[model samples]
Target: MDTPSSSARVCGERPFYDLHAEAYDLIINDPVKPWCDAVDAQLARSSSILDAGCGTGRHAAEMIARGHVVDLADAAPRLLAQAAARCPSARTQLIDICLLPTADHDAVMCRGVLNDMVSDGERAAAIASLARSLRAGGKLFLDVREAEASRERADGEPRTRSGFTSRTTWDNGLLRVRETYAMGGDVVEYQFTMRPWSVGSLTGLLRDNGLRNVSVGGGVGRRTPDRLFVVAF
Candidate 1:
């Protein structure tokens, strides 16, 4: 298996989560209740859950609230600190998803994180690591956007939030997103590059990593039509 080097090579060791840790919770206010409900339906009350790549403990908070033993892990330390603050009772750690510590979990969730890995090797390593973190019958839950739809939407127009303006374009067959933050005349620029995945490709990749019983469905709770929600055992 290959070690994950995309974060370092493309956007430093911690990537966007660490860079924007302070603004993450504020910027990402999308209601996670529905997504949590969907995942909750798949898990037992006492399941040992590992929220791998959990950013600021959104899902972890829900699981912990439901009386599950949830461990929150992320590659970004600042983000992990935020997760720790949000869910003080649950264990929080700074961990790379592609190099997770060996532990038997009843279910492991890698939500909205795998696409951050810019290369196939990094994505593969992350999946394999998730497999290793699971117990014999443990299941894995993940969600990602459809490549074609993402490309079309991104290329369609520019968008802005707060003081940040972003536009997506194609570069060398990869999606390149350029974001500029206006900070009182001093503008800061950031770029993110990602490769999109199809449902078939994602399902195959999970199975290739020894994750069986793979299934893909509409995005969690059917809120997002363009997203692909994946479940595997």
Candidate 2:
């Protein structure tokens, strides 16, 4: 849902969140506890965690509530501000997933972000960067919108929030969503392109990046199986 323009890369996706940061929580009401449970269950030890693209810092706050040391990172400074307010104790960093800092983390989580990479190269680079952020034997938990599910959603109803209306359409393997927002007298249109990766393909990507024990399952605490949560060590 956060994919950027071809010319601008992931950095281009920041404006959407920055503009909609105040209404982000209202639009996206997914509970964070289940994801926290899933991450906790897979952790061999809970010494430290890196929450990549930690929008609003809910995940980091949940992890911190569980007594795990947390580092919250995101490309959007506006979102990072919100995250900092939510989890005051977390170490906040302005980071890009494709160029994560070298650190040995017990677990690294990147939920609902991989699909944001519109190209294969960006996805590979992001996965490799996350792998580098992990220590040996550390687990990585990531989730992406399944390709089939994206195709199915193309036929669903459109959603609207904070003067913005969004509708999805699928062409070939790309999932495209067009959002139109009413900003006072001006109307702005934001179009995002995401490549939905299947579980098999995602598993291959993780293993190719030197990550092992990759497994894919339904998204944590979500009734719809559209999101595939992948765990690798």
Clashing pairs for model 1 are none
Which one wins on lDDT?
Answer: 2
Estimate candidate 1's alpha-carbon lDDT, on a 0 to 1 scale. 0.76
lDDT of 1 by residue, 1-233 (tens): 35445643432332336555576766566678877888789988888999987788988898888888999887777778888999998887676678887789999987767777767778777788889899988999987767877777677367877666778876654678787766455567887777767777778878897887998877774444657788899
- Cα TM-score per model: 0.89, 0.89
TM-score of 2: 0.89
lDDT of each: 0.76, 0.79
lDDT of 2 by residue, 1-233 (tens): 24432423543353357775676676566888888888887665456999998888888898888889999988777888999999988898887787787889998998777887777778777888889999988889887889998798776368876677888888899887787777555577888887888888888888997886988887786656678888898
Local error of candidate 1 at 216, Å? Answer: 0.7
Q: After superposing candidate 1 on the true structure, give the runs of residues whose Cα lies further than 4 Å from its correct spot.
A: 1-4, 8-16, 183-186, 221-224
- Candidate 1 residue 196 Cα shift, in angstroms, is 1.2
Worst 10 residues of 2 by lDDT: 1-10
